[model samples]
Target chain A: MKTLVLVEHGDGKVHDATLATVTAAGKLGSVAALVCGDGEEAAKAAAAAATVAGVDKVLLASGPAYAQMLAENVAALIVPLMDDYDALLCNASSNGKNVAPRVAALLDVMQLSDIISVEGDKTFTRPIYAGNAIATVESSDPKLVITVRGTAFAKAASEGGSAGVENVSGPGDQGLSSFGGCESVKSDRPELTSAKVIVSGGRALKDAETFKEVILPLADKLGAGVGASRAAVDAGYVPNDYQVGQTGKIVAPQVYIAVGISGAIQHLAGMKDSKTIIAINKDEDAPIFQVADIGLVGDLFKIVPELTGKL
Target chain B: MKILVAVKRVIDYNVKPRVKADGTGVDLANVKMSMNPFDEIAVEEAIRLREKGKAAEIVAVSIGPAKAQETLRTALAMGADRAILVETEDEVEPLAVAKILKAIADEEQPGLVLLGKQAISDDSNQTGQMLAALMGRPQGTFANAVEVEGDSVTVKREVDGGLETVKLTLPAVVTTDLRLNEPRYASLPNIMKAKSKPLSAKTPADYGVDTAPRLKTLKVSEPPVRQAGVKVADVDELVAKIKALGIA
Candidate 1:
């Protein structure tokens, strides 16, 4: 079997999620990486990414039409290429979620999202109901399109395989959509989903100003990514991107620190998989303490700063 | 211009779905069913556009059992002009759902299509993009904000990496994200008024779309629960435990 993996890259480097996706795809069959880009930079990134050990070949499409990787044009590029492979793989990133389903629909196949385990040639296990239940599905279709959660699989060894590169031409200028550009931050902090440690805040932080003041110092000291409970996000203490819950980004890092969070079941669905958990809440009965490996009952207003100072 | 919005009857977001002991699927008997929350935002966005004079009509739609008409009525109460229910009993997967919606869009000829990014139940964020693909229209998935002007739409999307924006022609699809807007509740009078609004029904066969599910459910079971670990006495103990776990 041959599996085709979508390659995601930025700043001329491959994303760790793409590497992990390759690892997961390797479990099914030999892998081919499809790197779609709008220019020379995307091509360079593809070349850099193709060296990951498991890839058997790299298919590069760097036409101007791919500028924003618009779901329409990108899915169009992928549909015709599906005839050569048995399965398609992509990280469960927003772009992947946006594109893969279109491909599945056009192929008249059902698309699987955020799959964690490949049970066999056709069966896979995935979480549903905000991680409360796991569902195992088996596809009857001849080909499959799957989006994988990066954290579930280990990254493939990048021991430098010399995979042959193949440039592919696509039907350009689909004219369905145009890119308006991205608003992104090249932050010193790690990306939250892949971060090893996370320090999350809740509504008790009062407001954005206090949230930053209390969460940032401690997070910076531990080099942790910052997260927020749904209540904190709903209270406008942080942007929606900072949300860590069933409706937001699901993370399973090494350590997760919750400050003032009451640990609603939805919040636990997102972070309960973290290897080590810590909680600091004034409410002694807050549900977060039930699963916390290290529970501190106190006021975060004073405790967070003191902990940061000591660290 | 007309805007077509699709809603789904899903298990309420607040409900914790229990897997059946036999492991076939989630037990939905006598469960509280509501319009998918994201679809409420979709209906709300369409109404806001009509209020702004960007849309002259808003048509809400759903595909499920007859009970789904309740979900559509909720959309009507929320301000949609009319609704269509493509009634089906089989479990509809996203691809089939997209096909059914495409058939509706083909007949409605709406300038824009809207839906929730994903239903909380299946959590498969697929229908909007798939409908756009089947119709050969532009798609803006995970939309945070939408602006309609002069036969075109611009959407700010909530992507994994920060935010990105896209501009598309009038005949497009846009999926709602969490931060799109706070959805409005239907007033009592509006609920009664919705009872009178026209809600037409059709079968999947009427649209020439197959309702069979492509994937078979082998089993549905509970995810492994995390066990409670040692609880430290204080911040000092917490820090000490972190050091001992080699997390610091």
Candidate 2:
């Protein structure tokens, strides 16, 4: 079977999730990559994707229409190219979730989303009910569209055999939607998904000011990415992007620190894969303690400061 | 201008579903069901638009079993003018759901179509974009904010990196995100009024859409469980443990 992996990139570099998706695609069969963007930067991204270990070839589709990744045009580009591949794979990122379904609709096939394990060429395992249960599914369609959860697979090597790049023009503009600008949170901290150490808080932190004042110092000391439980995010202690839970971004860091978090099942689903888990909370019976490799029962206000000072 | 809001009846977000012993699917015998949380946000957005005079009417649509009428009634009680239930008993996939909505959109000719970014049950996150592609219309997905003008809609979408703004022509599809708006509760009077609201029911065959399970479930099992570890006495012990683990 031939798998076409969609290579995700930004600022002219391949994303870590794309490398993980490539690893998932490699388990099925021969793997090729499709990198879509505009101008010379897109060509550069395609060249970067060609160096990934599992990829055999890179298909580059560059145009102004592809820049913002409008689903209509992006799906149109992938639909015609689907005839040559048995399966189409992408990272289960925001862009992938937006574009993969449209392609599946155009091809009249069902999409297998957020697959954590590949049982065979056509069978896969995915989390259901907010990650409480895992469902193994098999698709009978002639072609398959799938999105791979990055946390479940290891990243494919970035350097290996040199694969050839082929440039092709994508489908025409749909003229229904246009790019309007993007505003991203400017942060110097490591990204949550790829961070080696993560410091996450919950609603117990009280207010946003206290949340930042208490969490940032410790995170800074450990050189860790900051994350939040859904309760903290809902309480406006942090932005939604910092949410680490079933409804938020799934992460698997080397060390995960849960401070003032109760560890709801939703939150546990996202970070249970971390190598070493530590929890600090005032309550000894907090659900977070159940999963923590090392638990500390104490007031975070005092304990966190002391921990930070000691570090 | 009419606004079509797509609602889905799913297992209540508060309920933790259990897989059957036979490994078929989630047990739904006694579980509570409600309108999907994100779909409630979409309905709220539509009601707000109608109140602002951007929409002349709001129509709530759901594709599920007959019990889905309860979800439509919830939408109606929340201020939708009417409701439509595409009744079906089979497991309808996202592509088929998009096709059914496309048929409804063709007949209703609504100025805007709104839906949740995804349902928590399947979490496919596909129907809205697929419907837009089928109708050859623009799509604004994962929208945290939406502003409808005379001929177009401006949306602020929640993306992985951050917020992205996009503009789409009229008759476009918009999917709601978590932070879009807080949905209001339906008061007692509105609940009484919703009983009188017009709710029409139809089958997938009426729309010439094939609603079938495209994927087969091989097995359902619980994920690996994590065991509780030892507890430390205080910050000193916690730090010692961390240093011993060589993680920090």
Kindly list the per-residue Cα lDDT of model 2 for residues A161-252, writing each as its tens digit: 48999987766688888889998888999999899999999999999999999999999999999999988987889887898977688899
DockQ metric for all predictions? 0.77, 0.78
Q: Tens digit of lDDT per residue, candidate 1, span A1-311?
A: 89999998877778889899999899999999999886778878778767898999999988878867788888989999999999999888887898899888889889988898999998999888888789999999999999998878988866586798899877877887899998876678888888999999999999999999999999998899999998898788877778897768888889999999999878987898898889999998898988888888888998899889877
Worst 10 residues of 1 chain A by lDDT: A156-165
lDDT of 2: 0.91
Clashing residue pairs, backbone N/CA/C < 3 A, model 2: none
TM-score of 1: 0.98
TM-score to native of every candidate shown: 0.98, 0.98
RMSDs, each prediction?
Answer: 1.3, 1.3
